[model samples]
Target: MALSIVYGILTTVLTATSWRLGLAVDGILWLVFLVPIILAVIGIINAVNGKMKPLPVIGGIKILK
Candidate 1:
């Protein structure tokens, strides 16, 4: 959620700055969006098997309890 917000802001800023930079930001945003969907799929599989596993990179962060 935080990442998406930050990326949105960055994308807006970059778009205002330059078209080339905005395109680069768009590509990066796509990759960032994929991370959570992939993690959620893995998480769902683990849940079905009764396992509690953290995601690889973002799971360790204690942003919410």
Candidate 2:
């Protein structure tokens, strides 16, 4: 959640600064933003399914907490 907000801000800032940074944000976000978001979604889904399990590497990233 927190990381998403940070990334959103950084993305908006960098995107407005230069086209290169904007491209970098798009490319990097697949691994950086998308990965964590996907993992978090999976974690939440599992929880809703009544399966207890952490989301791979993303579960440990405290930036969202």
- Which candidate leads in TM-score? 1
Please give, for residues 1-65, the per-residue lDDT of candidate 1 as tens digits: 78778888888899899989998988988997988799888888999999988876777899867
> What tens-digit string does per-residue lDDT give for candidate 2 at 1-65?
88778878888888889979887986787586567688778888998999977568755667754
TM-score list, all predictions = 0.56, 0.47
lDDT of each: 0.86, 0.79
Candidate 2, pairs of clashing residues: none
Model 2 bad stretches (over 4 Å): 34-65
Superposed by TM-score, candidate 2 places the C-alpha of residue 14 at a distance from the truth, in angstroms, of 0.4
Report the alpha-carbon TM-score of model 1 versus the true structure: 0.56
